[model samples]
Target: MTRVVGKRAARRAELFDQLVGLFLDEGFAHLTLDDVAARLRCSKSTLYTLAESKDDLVRAATVHFFRRAADEVEEALARVDSGAGDRVTAYLEAVGDQLAPASARFMEDLARMPGARGVYEQNTAIAAERVRTLIAEGVGAGEFRSVSAEFVADVVASTMVRIQQRDVARATGFDDAQAYRELAALVTRGIAR
Candidate 1:
């Protein structure tokens, strides 16, 4: 029984990964269950085991992508033993790297869907708080100049929201990943002692 359960879990995980990759490459806005099943080479029943409906599946995939990205970002940050500035840069660049794989269409679809967008917004808020903590630590450690962590975090969060909304892309002709890279450089230079 345990063996059967483990195999089922592994299969589900494999399907979930394939689904995410498909969604990342091509937007999920137009893909139907039949399309998904055909692309994944699995039955509709197998997709149902992942999510109840198409929207639910998209949300699940978005959640999975963000969760995996967060884990990777933290792992990347952990590898940095340097000062807080380097840590902040590392965190943001890691975020950029994680997001680089997503297509513009996927991002557009994400913004259009409320459930998926909510997950993204929630993650952005959490990331803002994380940035706030990193800035505070930098200040305390004398690695960064005396700047208001709250203010800096608020700025970063606002920029992230704009990036998510596609305003930055429209205005600067930069993708989300490129915008994040520019943001990291700007913030590190702005806050440096």
Candidate 2:
């Protein structure tokens, strides 16, 4: 993880990190310029230095957090010391763990904001590809039963998106973490011989 500052000076990296935590704790969409300024102990102008408006700030922060979360999930997968099937479980578990901290408000904000949803959809695509690869690998190694890797991967990925749906999550009465845990069990059982 190169500093998330992204070309800005080291100070902006610090500010971004601080802002990310705040946004994660309190929903980004609900935050005001004054709220950000007060939280960061900076003036509204300083807040403007980072974003053009509250919506822009929310969009930027949403992008930044999703990018960081994707990177962290990749890192977590890399650190898993297991076969592909277990790695898949670890990957899903890590994703759930990563999202474990997000408040329902934060989740709702991400669901409603188009910019944030785009970031999330991109991340979901990446995860789907990763699952496809992992399934193919497991099949090649004779660990998993021969199956349609792409189909299974697509199912897994689609379930991931379904679990994240606000209404679905509410209807099922499962938070994102539990949804993922259940997904892991459902997938691994169905796929395992």
Candidate 3:
């Protein structure tokens, strides 16, 4: 994973953002240095200016993408929504937004890559903890049912993982984003007092 610190980190982030969509369209395993360069409209030498190998490039890009995603989700949580429920829903939607454009193949590739999977797992866990905090706040405000926030938080996190599964999406005819919307609705209603 790229430390993403130091001079010209903004330039590095900009480059990573440009490549994220390409990687999501054609997973790391399928994309070669030539393919990346072609898609990026840059030369292999320019890519080497960022990373030494293809694998390193992918790892850094994945990490950088997820880091930006987490920041967005946190920003969503901090917004002054209509209510705590809305805030939570916005946060969940933000989570979905992170991978809104990722293809199923991209998801499968993520599972196959340990480093990428770690970034995904860590983000989900953070989302889960944030959900727990919101749930407790809602309950305290008498806006949500007085339920076990921790348990429900765990369920929300697990549901997030399940929503990303290809089989679940195929069986339900809901893409990851749709699955998240439905799940958010279910959770909001399920916990509503």
Question: What tens-digit string does per-residue lDDT give for candidate 2 at 90-188?
Answer: 888878888888888888888888877777777778878888888898888887889898999899888878766675587787888778878877777
Q: Give me the displacement of residue 92 in model 2, in angstroms.
A: 0.7
Q: Could you give candidate 3's per-residue lDDT for residues 1-193 as a string of tens digits?
A: 3654554677666778888878888777888999898888889987898889887788778888788888887887677568878977887887787778888878888877877777777777887898999999999999998999999999998887776546557679777777777777888889987
List the candidate numbers ranked by TM-score, top first: 1, 2, 3
Model 1, 78-184: lDDT tens per residue?
99999999999999889888989989999999999999999999999998899999999999999999999999999999999998988999999898899999999
Clash counts per candidate, in order, are 0, 0, 0
For model 1, the stretches where C-alpha displacement exceeds 4 angstroms are none
Which 10 successive residues of model 2 have the least lDDT summed? 1-10
Candidate scoring better on TM-score of 1 and 3:
1
Worst ten in a row by lDDT for model 3:
1-10
lDDT (Cα, 0-100) at 38 in candidate 1:
100
State every prediction's TM-score relative to the real structure: 0.98, 0.89, 0.87
Greater TM-score among 2 and 3 belongs to 2
